[model samples]
Target chain A: MTAKATAPTPAPSHRGDAEWLSMRERGTVLGIRAAYWLAIAVGRSAMRPLVALVAMWYALFDRKVVRASRAWLLRVHGRPAGFWQVYRHLRTFAQVTLDKVYLLTDHTRALRFTRTGHELLAAQFASGQGAILLGAHLGSYEAMRAGGETTDLPIEILGYFANSRMINSLLARLSPRAAAKVIHLGDDPIGVMTRVQDSLAAGRFIATMGDRTGLTDRIVRAPFFGQEASFPAGPFLLASVLRCPVYLVLGLYRAPDCYDLHCERFAERIELPRQDRAARLQQWVRRYAERVEHHARSAPDNWFNFFDFWAAPPAAPPSPPPP
Target chain B: MSQTDATLEDQLKRLIVDTLALEDVAPESIDTNAPLFGEGLGLDSIDALEIALAIHARFGVRTVANDEKNREYYHSIKSLADFVRARQGEAQASAAPA
Candidate 1:
């Protein structure tokens, strides 16, 4: 056989494309979302069949792409779910579009819930010292609206919201609930971080993702699920740099309108004791990775990292040493 | 400065080992003239940037973007040695008790 070439994978030249999957050319998805929001605005159940028909058509005619996509998810991620199961998940992805539109239109009713973690949240809020709520994409985290409404402190979600301007504007209009507490940390991160710090200083309760890599330069490599992955050191770095406490909290979906509010101590206070800020930040990343792995492993079906976690080549044999 | 240069390769090896936490890498085994980007060490762009930052903090060397000097400087232990020698010369000249 001819010798194979070792070249870097063909990727977008922009560093931001390396950051994460781009939403720029996602006009089809945007169009679907726009149609949903328009239906919601018309205040008629008239478009109900139209929306279901679109979902049905995708499930029926989009067989090739969905099969390949499902196969990849199964092959790469051990998704034991069958073709129909994967189709259901994709079908529900459209349902989430409805959620986004509903959130913008009727934020309170959509995000409304009965609180359970009262004493725990209250003490955290009462402390006047900000706490980090480590949440993942398990449940309708918008239920956090009820969480904030119950507590004395402001429960602000520090997340990288949708980049699509049209979708975001729709989300703001369609879901008044999400618009109230949702703060978008778009491309310019340090500026958004200044706001996060200000919120924390005001003794507000903060919730941010501890799973995926963040939008900043700071990163820490750690082992996750028997493979190496890079975790964002920004949150931990901020905790260390800002001398704050970090809590591991997750809102996992149980059923319709019900969720399990899980909480555990990842690392309480990450203030730099004697070492440099970077070292302390590394410590926080280590704990965060362990917690993320533990939680994801606990619910592998719920592990949401669809992209390659390790980013290593598939089926490559270890080569012999170079001369 | 030769004393520092004597241990320079060892320092760089230590830097990579420490920054990446690679299980199999040893300082003495890293080829002096091997390519760090591709076949030699099999390092990626992220690793290059990661090791670059750590090396800068430790050795006072700044890695510029899209720079060709890196290909030459990162060629082998000998190339890094020569570059460090020039930097050390400048540092010494600037610090000659002026």
Candidate 2:
């Protein structure tokens, strides 16, 4: 047999595609706007079939999403993923996205939440100091926000929202109060830092994603799912600078209507001294990756990063070696 | 500028240079009025955090997180010196007896 015939099919090269930031937000504004209004008008029970239809459309037509989903599923399951599995993955994402409408609108009476390690957060609040809640893209952060509202805990989301302008704008319209809670990462560095600091100092938790690396963010490589992937060092660096406690919080979707909000302390404080800064950063990132892996393995379908997460990062000039 | 303010600015310039590890850029080379971020020294977010930490550790004067004036205060070396001096004055006043 020819060498080519004997070889496994090479995965399509996504190197040409810029990072997730550059990926177009997929659906048309009008379509998403229409969907949002429809969900609000008809309510979730009536919207389930339509959501499934839309998810099915994406699962069938979006080749990139399908490939990414299959890749993640294979790693999680240790077997080839079936077409139905991919469809269900897309459907789950669609359901969660749709739920954001109700969550943002304070219509969370229909949804259920089970919280664990809440006492840890309570103890942190008892200290009269703010802490950082590091979350991932695995599940519904909105659910956690809703839970916080009921308990009178203020949470500010620090995120880069340039990519999802349409969705963000629509969601903001859903609840101006909820919109105010978002601290968009933008041009004003001092403003962003000060806002985060102020919130933390006031004993309000600041929630941010630990996974996605921004365009100019410093990143560290960590072994994830038996492969090396880049995780942003920004969160950890910010934690060290702010001199605040860091906690891992994930709001996992347990299908149908329940969200399990899990919170655990990641660090009392992240200290990266000048003597061993890189190594310390690497250790924190590795532990972060391990925690993310542990959770992702348990809730395999909750993984929402619909991109080639393991693809080689864009090259950058190497830093000068440590003295 | 007052002699103390000038000295404070110079001290801040050295702190920025050393804290960020600007290899070729000398402390004195940093202009007092030149912006510290975005097009001036060409620093990013991480650099800002480093400078914040260094200032906190070295001067023991913490930058107030919610102060609306932080943007202006961090604009340049001169402004940072002003901020530090003002905060120092406030701390001293708060400590003094009525």
Candidate 3:
């Protein structure tokens, strides 16, 4: 007999009302998988609407998610940009999010644009050089997956996986070629780092999140976008341990289907100096900030860090209790 | 099912409370008749799998997914305890060789 499909029981009062929402999330996950198979089996047109719907939903929603997102933008940026500025960035973020689906489904030449920063990636990977590909939450930065597809290079990503195994299995089956290359170390901190170190030792590329904290407190404080916030130390520490060249590889979504795969040489060969490791990390952190800063300043909304950011003082103690 | 075994029941309740990270839940508050995953302790699919794994490793009792009776037995701590008791008794009976 097949394993019983036991779904999570959401909170009670809204149990009857919430079934639709729970189904929606499941649908969203399935849609993503279906889009993948559609891309491979039925080809490109099958995925166009899937990508479009993702972008439109984020762009059109004004109150619930968008309103909260706008508040998040204010808190992170310290001030609001013009209407067009916010809209442009949100549109870019949405488009890039969709762009990932399109990239996964389509072939290489199906991509429209120059391979702008690929040489930088190769140069960093040459010899015993293994660097962290520090990426922002902005754009559909799945270009690295595409890169592994195009080149014989072994690129492994240290990232979060969906909670659903069904989805994971489908994704692996969908893109068997690139799926083997992508190393998604979801919750295992020690194991994740070990895999990164192992992959690098084998002269393979390991890419992880430049921003965001893991479940526990694997976060470190840093100043970004003009405020004190934390970015995961996994990227920097992994770079230090492996002693590899580090590049900030980002794929910016320019339009509906098209994207600009930009790879800039942020830093090559960073030294921990044997004594002051934190200082060495700060130097690399500054370089990561500079690289992201370059793009974020140009396309402010394209920086899709959904949670609160730089506005808060680093580890500013929790606010006083309300009377 | 009414064993009047308060200590053993409390120990199991504590395990449920701690393992699942049931934030607002109290051990005494969890009703024996209420569902542990859904209506009672409020756990999810991943948590259910985790709890199932925890039960197998801790108790040395491997739960059979194929068993139709597991639907009623896996529903609550009391039900689960009874199933375990029955299984253990069967083991003892077989070991004694008639």
Candidate 4:
């Protein structure tokens, strides 16, 4: 049964969740606009040093975030991380965030994007049988959107905004068209399903992140980075319900203005039978985790989840015998 | 129920119980009109996909892959039986000479 939330609610705050929450709340649209205009005027070449300086400031002041980044980098890199490594990690995130200004403002002429497996998306579009693009927070999702604009395929993002009120208005102000494509998960579940169905039926691609989960979102445990981690079940469920093909898409930020966009066909369709629900779901989740880990290892800093990812969960007592 | 149709329904009911591992619910106890999903048998999207696979395996009839479109066919045992019967009829007619 679909959980009862027609509207987005506050995601339970873990360290990682809080970082995302605070990052937006700490800065206003005006501030983002100022950075955008500055980058545009001086060019990314001139803005690099300034962005690094800002990244350094955050790394120094935000102890919690730095610790989280440092811990993740250690696992991803398989080596001890120093202050400079952590700083670079934070800087990568800042640079990508700043680039959104250029991306949304229709000034991405300088950024270079190389896409692989784009033919899969093209084929899906050509067939008028749309597919689901399951993405993660590892890189610049905006780069994918930029590519979508160029390819002329309609892309709608499915996301749950914890502080959507503020961000939504900013999105409306910055790019009204972009704001319209967002299918907020916090809205009514049935409404979300209907809208998603319409989009798929119209052969438009729906982009959703498979990495994160909402406060109430049901999740399954899978092996990630050599340890079991919780991954959200919503993406697979959506694919099964839609009966659509699934594709894995990632836009890895390479340099100042270069990104490598990768698209891999994940599955023709998700077929989960009731008899082995847990095991079947686990297999799919494991495959996704392995793929994400492969990408994250290549670009360690681009992995945006800044939390104690490997922390142990609260204890669970043994279950009673079944009836 | 006619012998042939009764056997078809009984076969489908058995498949549902076996594929879904609903061990507690006996095949004969499944009300043909009782819903198979949410608020009925309390199945979810995953369960729906599984049932589709089971249907394909047992009857050699391909249910429409899209859940939105498949809702009518999967609504209950009666609907599923009718869907299978219709498809099997079409297959037989196409194969027979005029």
Candidate 5:
């Protein structure tokens, strides 16, 4: 029997209420399987109309996703997002998602990439001291990964995958080699850290998302797109603890068949002194958030965070005014 | 608990307090059996990493990541002390001879 779908209510009550981790995957396994095989068989160019249909389906029926896309587009464009704009946003997401199939299947010969700041990655590789690749949910990280694979760079993905198990497993099956490179973050904190340290020591890049926070993640608020939003401090904190260089990498999907891969050295090392640890974390996280904002604005349709990005924490009870 | 285990736990408590710069929390006030994460002390994974680093630096015992018993070993001050002591024993045994 198919699992009953539970639509997540978007009411902002607690921090977990708006957390992306609490949201369920949108499509069904059977539907995803069919789409995957269809994309693989008919190729990306032929699947555009079908993908648009799927994106349109979500845009029309999935009220939560539509509301989120509209809100995000409004913030970035400084105007109410029209229905087509939201549709385009979802369509971009769908197109990028479809590309992951080709990316993982070793069929990247057809893909084209224009990389900026590639020398930064080259320098780190030459130094034999692996760097952390900090990316966001803005664009297709898989594009960057596919590029790394082509260039013979050993890149491992470090992420939490509980939410997208179905798709992750499907992609894993498509490319066991790529899936083997994943370091899943789970209950075993020590295990994860040890593996990360070992990978860095061995000069393998660890790519992780810096935007979304897990349910129990420590967070710091940063101003993004003219409003304060919570960003996870874990990525910055891990960078500091690992004492490694960090580089901001984004693969903006240009329509049709091109990806503009942008890479910039973010920091040599993030230092969080005990005396001002919280402030230091805030500074680093804010800087990262600013970088994400810059890219998100440049490629507004590439923005993929389909949640209430600006949900404020539950309001504290007001105190009596001084007499 | 033996006196030495108690002493080790106290030492770890002080190390955690100092390493994490946990303001408003006295080392002695920390319960030996109270959870260090998500509840009693409310420490998170970052804190766990900090503690692991400090434990390695102070005790010369590396807390191997990916160990199936990491969750158990890092559960509390007492458990951490036990983990350190066991690792120290293993180190000594290995360094002794073939």
Candidate 6:
């Protein structure tokens, strides 16, 4: 007799009640995957019409995503967002997703990147010290990876991989270099952290996104664009324990087959004394939010949170009366 | 507990509390057999790494590449302090004007 399959236990989440958090693998659309292969067989220029068609279809049909897009655009642009503007935002997202196939599948000819702040990364590498490259959904992290591939530094990415294992394995089969570097974060936090420590010890760059909260950790709430949002406390805590420099890395898509890879030093080192752990966590989280807001203003279409980022924050626990 | 082991445990507890910046955790309150990971101390992988670093800095012990053995060594404060003491003894013996 077949034993009943046990249901998987959901990891505790410290994120806001944003609808996107419930969705699995936003980039796993079958049509998009098929088009990616077609773009590979033909050129990205030939695939443009298809990408635009797909983007337009989503803009017209997916009301929730379009509405979210409009809300984010209005918030960033400081003005009423028009339908055409929202459509452009969706189109940019679709274009970036399409470019991922080229970036990850080893089709490098399609991308032309202008890099800044790379000297900071080079200096960190030269010092024989590991660093945390905190990134966001605002741009192509794949481009950042591609740009850094030329350097001898081994780059490892920390991301959720349970739902995308099949797709990840398939893609990894196509690009072994990218596959070897991923340290899956969800299954076991202890395992992930130990592997991260190993990578840092071996002088590898540990890259993770700071904008999205992990599903299994406590969040540090901070103000984003004048509204409260929750950010994961893990990376910042990891930075403190590791006592290493932290840098912000973004790879904004500039044009068809072109991107501007930007990197900026975020912190010399994260220090969390026992007396100031709470306040320090909040301070660093707020600083990260400010940087994300600044970048989102410049590339209005690149903010990929696609959820109600300004939702009401959870209530803080009451403090005990002073003695 | 012997005076030496008690002192080692106290030193390890202080090292852990300071290195991890743990809140609400006093060194004297840490149990000798309490696990270093997960539910016991609520410490994650980064804490394990920091503990490893602290052990190296204070006792000149390095974590091996074998993850299973490392986990055994890091199972509890008692296990970790024992590993450090043994390693220190070995180092001292090897360097004793041979």
What ranges in model 6 sit over 4 Å off?
A1-36, A147-153, A163-172, A177-180, A255-257, A313-323, B1-11, B21-23, B33-40, B59-98
lDDT of 2 by residue, A114-216 (tens): 9888888888878889999999988877777675633556777787654345555665687666533666676467667867877898898988899987766
Tens digit of lDDT per residue, candidate 3, span A1-323? Answer: 00001223432333221332334335435555544444556545554554445545554653343554576567556776545545555556544544455565446455665467787767655765566677876565676557443444556665554434555565566566554344544443333444565566667777666865543223566667666666666666556545667777777655545556677766666666545766777777776776777776655556665434553323532432221
Pairwise TM-score winner, candidates 1 and 6:
6
TM-scores for the candidates: 0.54, 0.80, 0.59, 0.70, 0.87, 0.79
Instruction: Estimate the overall C-alpha local distance difference test score of candidate 3.
Output: 0.56
Q: How good is model 6 by TM-score?
A: 0.79
lDDT of 5 by residue, A12-107 (tens): 335543444434233323434556577778887888887788788888887877998999988888889988998899888888877867777767
Model 3: residue A312 alpha-carbon error in angstroms: 4.2
Over the stretch A132-238, how does candidate 6's per-residue lDDT look in tens digits?
Answer: 99999897887776745443456777876555455556556656765336666755554466677777766678988898765555578898887888888888988
- Residue A304 C-alpha lDDT in model 1: 35
Q: Tell me the whole-model lDDT of each prediction, alpha carbons only.
A: 0.54, 0.76, 0.56, 0.72, 0.77, 0.73
Pairs of residues clashing in candidate 5: A190-B65, A191-B65, A191-B66
Report per-prediction Cα RMSD to one decimal: 11.2, 7.5, 12.6, 8.2, 5.0, 6.1
Q: Which predicted model would earn the best DockQ?
A: 5
Query: What are the clash counts of all predictions, listed in order?
Result: 9, 0, 1, 5, 3, 0
Model 5 stretches astray by more than 4 angstroms:
A1-33, A148-151, A163-172, A177-180, A314-323, B1-6
Is 2 or 4 the stronger prediction by lDDT? 2
Ranking of models by lDDT: 5, 2, 6, 4, 3, 1
Docking class of 4: incorrect
Residue range A1-323, candidate 1, lDDT tens digits = 00000111333544332333333224323554555546566542454455455555655665543554464356436755565665554434444334434433443343334445545666776788777776654343444443444333466666555544544554455544443354555532433454565667778767777665544334566766566666665566556545567777754433233334556666667665433655766666777777766655544334434345555322233553552
Q: Can you write out model 6's per-residue Cα lDDT over B1-98, one digit (the tens) per residue?
A: 23565588799998899887765778888888987776577676667767877777877787754345677778888998888888888888998975
Provide the fnat value for model 1, as a fraction from 0 to 1: 0.02
| DockQ of candidate 3 relative to the true structure | 0.02
lDDT by residue (A87-119, candidate 4, tens digit) is 988888888877777776657777898888888
Number of colliding residue pairs in model 3: 1
